[model samples]
Target: MSQGDEQRTAKVEPLRKARPCPECRRPSTRDNYPFCSDRCRNLDLSRWLKGSYAIPVADDESKADDDYRD
Candidate 1:
């Protein structure tokens, strides 16, 4: 309504998305998020199954040694 209000509105603008889906490059929804859709999400999953994903594990092998020590 006023200049101050307008200035405040401008300062507190709506948040924007980083980018579209990486697989299909389509605009992503908040539900499906970065994948865009279930198909794209599954595709990404398949890529993981195809050895694209690697979950890091701790390199410290202390667990095995701890049992033997005690």
Candidate 2:
């Protein structure tokens, strides 16, 4: 194969860096990505299901006052 052909076959985009698992500080797997294993992934899911992880909702004073008047 010619050098030009080999160059054309090469990857055009930059490779992504491997991110550590959120639950455990370990290299992630293809199947259980973002988490190292099923156990770690399940634990995270349980937290969410049990309302352990919450997103804080800021109450807008002006909007609430106008829209939700009794």
Candidate 3:
């Protein structure tokens, strides 16, 4: 391999480290990414669509008070 070839064939590292699937807890694949398979990916999506996942927000009492104008 010439110097030019070596330079051209540089090793490319993945931007993020592979992690276990959130559903099955299996090693993730390049195709499915964070999930091990399509099933796991779809399952996660279904959960989101079904409102199984949610972000909690604190109720602002101050804002509630502001809604009532004197």
Query: What is the C-alpha lDDT profile of model 1 across 1-70, one tens digit per residue?
Result: 9999888778554366556998989888767778789999889989988998788766777886796898
Identify the candidate with maximal TM-score.
3
Query: Which stretches of candidate 2 lie above 4 Å from their native place?
Result: 1-16, 59-70
Screening candidate 2 with a backbone cut-off below 3 angstroms (N, C-alpha, C), the clashing residue pairs are none
Clashes of 2: 0
TM-score per candidate, chains pooled: 0.49, 0.62, 0.68
Alpha-carbon RMSD of each model = 5.6, 4.5, 3.4
In model 2, how large is the Cα lDDT of residue 46?
98
Better of 2 and 3 by TM-score: 3
Model 2: lDDT equals 0.84
Q: Note the Cα lDDT for every prediction shown.
A: 0.81, 0.84, 0.92
Candidate 1 residue pairs that clash = none
Alpha carbon deviation, residue 39, candidate 3 (Å): 0.5
Clashes of each: 0, 0, 0
lDDT of 2 by residue, 1-70 (tens): 9999999999876255667899888988767887889999999999999999988865776876777786
Instruction: Supply the global lDDT for candidate 1.
Output: 0.81
